[model samples]
Target: MNAGEEPGVVAMDVESTHMPTNSEEFVDAPNFDLETYISRYEGFSKIQRLQYIARRCPRLKNDAYRLAIKDLKEGCNTASYKEIMATVGDSLGPGYGYDAAWCEAEDRKAAAARERLELELNQFKTNLIKESIRMGYHELGRHHAARGDLAAAFKCFVRTRDYCTTGRHSAE
Candidate 1:
């Protein structure tokens, strides 16, 4: 970090996503700009992003489901959600299934959790897009899709598509 040192790269130890608070880092970190990073780094594609999430959330059942669903929606050739869910069930180990009442209750709880997680993910994606777009030039949609933030990603993709079509007509 010393000046006149040719700005040598400093290696910082980023915390691993395996820890419980690792996911929270994505939310709390100010530099977690989905759009900016993706637009800047050509190496981080949609497939790579999904793979990263799969690696990071290996045991987290719902995370895999969410990641797979987002990847499929974003035109990724990833394994289907059912496949991921089956693996998740196996990861959950034996005797994970419950009887009728318990199953119903768990389903309800899962549905609620999914809804909440989707809302939060979309909100984060939206915020990043809005912020990055205001800076102009870079596309904000790709990062959302890459990170499995499907709702916001889809919204941004549609907007980008519409903008392009509108420009084409205006140019004509």
Candidate 2:
């Protein structure tokens, strides 16, 4: 122990204190099939994993971004979509299948879907049918997941547990 230093405390060097903000430097892998690899994941994780790969792997950046954009188009994550588009434009060039009109339309559609699902859930609650309420929450959870609202989806899914009346429902 150094003079006046705590017995258990060890002074950290500058290099040890320096933490990398980004990912470990990626080495391009030969025969790496991005499609087959990405197919292993599902739901929101697929897009996020693809984005992570795109950011880290220089060789696979374009391909990863392309796949991520395609997946994003199917969901309501406009912010991530736009962010990816901007990154692609900055790194490579513009016109990698970005559509502003689609983003706007998707926002509207998602809002409408959320409203409809919430209304249906409210109706199911008023009916006081446990099964219907459970199903309603499940559907709402699915809608929120498709809309990129994971927290709401998780809450809705968790709410289904309260209405579960059978082992099968609990398993589901």
lDDT of 1: 0.44
Question: TM-score for all predictions?
Answer: 0.22, 0.80
For model 1, how does the per-residue alpha-carbon lDDT over 12-106 read when each residue is reduced to its tens digit?
55764355544421222333444343344332254355445455543433443454444444343222333444555544334332124543454
Residue pairs with backbone atoms closer than 3 Å in model 2 (clashes): none
lDDT of 1 at 138: 18
Scored against the true structure, residue 126 in model 1 reaches a CA lDDT of 71
The whole-model C-alpha lDDT of candidate 2 against the native structure comes to 0.86
Per-residue lDDT tens digits for candidate 2, residues 1-172, read 7788988887878876877685577868668899999999876899999988887788888888888888888778887888888777655456566798999999898889889989988999999999999999999899888877789989999999999999999998
Off by over 4 Å in 2: 1-23, 90-97
Clashes of each: 0, 0
Q: Residue 97: error of model 2 in Å?
A: 4.9
Q: In model 2, where is the ten-residue run with the lowest total lDDT?
A: 89-98
